[model samples]
Target chain A: MKRLTLALMVLMLSACVSVEYVTPYDPVIDNGIREYKESINTLAKNLGDQAGTEAGTYEANLAHYNALESKIDLLIERANLQSAGRGCRLAEGISAQLAKVAPEPMIQTEEGDSYGCTERLLVLVKDQLDLLQNIHQSADKCNAMASPRGTKISCLRATTSKAAMKITNQSINAVWVVETAKKNGDNG
Target chain B: MSVNFEQVLANILDSAASAFGDGWDSIKTYAPAEFKKISSQIVEIAENVAKYQLNDNEGYSAQTGKLLLQMQRNATEGVLVAVSTLTLIAVQNAINAIFASLRETFNDALGAIL
Candidate 1:
């Protein structure tokens, strides 16, 4: 009779442990991805405004600026999907841990187990944001030089060209970060 | 008239380059190594800008415009690679100063042309 009681208690405790392990944590990644997307949108709007101003006199450069805006928009979408996929994987990991009845602690400890990669992702996004802001400032400076009598067209052209290249570089960086995160998640 | 325009443009680019070089020399020693790489690139870009014959071709504006664009890219690249916040801000300030001096030179040339 005592053996039966001991067995039942052990089974109940294991069940409880499994339930604890499978419980999903709040999706912090979702919030981070949202914030990044918002920033990208803001940058796109600023670039669009600059493109509008430049369209009157510098149609060729305006086309380049428009292309940059499109690239950034695509990047934001790709990043959002990648980040959401990562979040899903993390949740699945928790579920797998529960199914295996692994004795290890839950996937997310108090210290934030997913933070290493997430923080790296955030940093990369922030870097892109900084570059965009710099481009915006440069565009503003170019606009200031657009007076009717003495418009510094060379300066405007230079600023636009610089902005285009910077955006390209930043887009490449964003793609790299997403690829890296996907690889890391897959490996885990 | 053509020779004079060429001379004037050359002189403007030279003065701009010298001013930029002086500004870079003052700050390069204190800048981080990554920024040093960028500063070197900036110098090369300035040299290229100065080499263009602004009076010989109708595309003179386009050519100089491209070099200035390259300069901005180099500066942005520097900012991206910066390891620390302080280094990023410093690099940005250096770039702004460089561009500011170049812009002043361009304004002077505009004044002369007018």
Candidate 2:
């Protein structure tokens, strides 16, 4: 009878063990991230092929950059809108820990804690897009200065483009992993 | 009706073990693989930057290489964050499953109180 009482107590307490460890999976966010990744990869390839050409100039590609940036901003907003309380505590904790161990601090948006993990990941993607733009613009500037001397210039070096592509894919995979885990559970 | 402590204990243990078993499998397979992938990416960035610096026309300035390295660091952080999230979700599911498995037993013991 004592053991029965103890078991009843345990079962009753376990009944209230609910907690929200992370946000629920959103199909829209998952699909948006995958599509955005494809777009970036395509852009990287185009930039690589036209590196030394007029088409590769940052000015020529400004519209494409703007469009991608806008898209990412929209994705971020969607992620923000879905912010459940205590959103992705694990992600928040990991980011905090990594900030300490990283050689430099992790990049964070100006709003910081106002956004959740998904929004944060999208922000990182936006930063990468901006970095790519800087790389392209730098090459264009170099070309502008060297044109009078008849020197050849590459707007986006192939090596740099490849590295950019790899890192971008890595970033996107991070978000993909999280979303997959949420959707597929153990199989994820 | 009185509860059978032995059977309840066994059922709870079996339920908890099954739930956690799957979660452990995910940790074993996913975490290390992702860490390895991210590490390789970081190494490749350094290698490519070195080669880019050696090229005459396609050379990237030290600053640009530094920028890429910084981005690599961000990617690594992102991967770590995602993995942590994955682990948490697994644990959450496991806990929920354990509690759920007790539902029927609790209902039987407490006359539908659960």
What value of lDDT does candidate 1 attain over all alpha carbons?
0.38
Determine which window of 10 residues in candidate 1 chain A has minimal summed lDDT.
Answer: A17-26
What tens digits encode model 2's per-residue C-alpha lDDT throughout A1-188?
Answer: 86588576766765675555666788887898888898888888997778766777677888888888888888788887776322333334444556555765564444443226766677677888887787777732244343466555547766778877888788888888888877886443
Task: Supply the DockQ value of model 1.
Answer: 0.01
Weakest lDDT window of 10 consecutive positions for candidate 2 chain B: B11-20
**Model 1 residue A145 distance off true place after TM-score fit, in angstroms:** 26
True contacts kept of each: 0.00, 0.46
TM-score of each model's chain B: 0.29, 0.62
Candidate 2 structure quality by residue, lDDT tens digits, B16-98: 23433544455556655555555565556556556556864554666667777777766766765565566777777888777
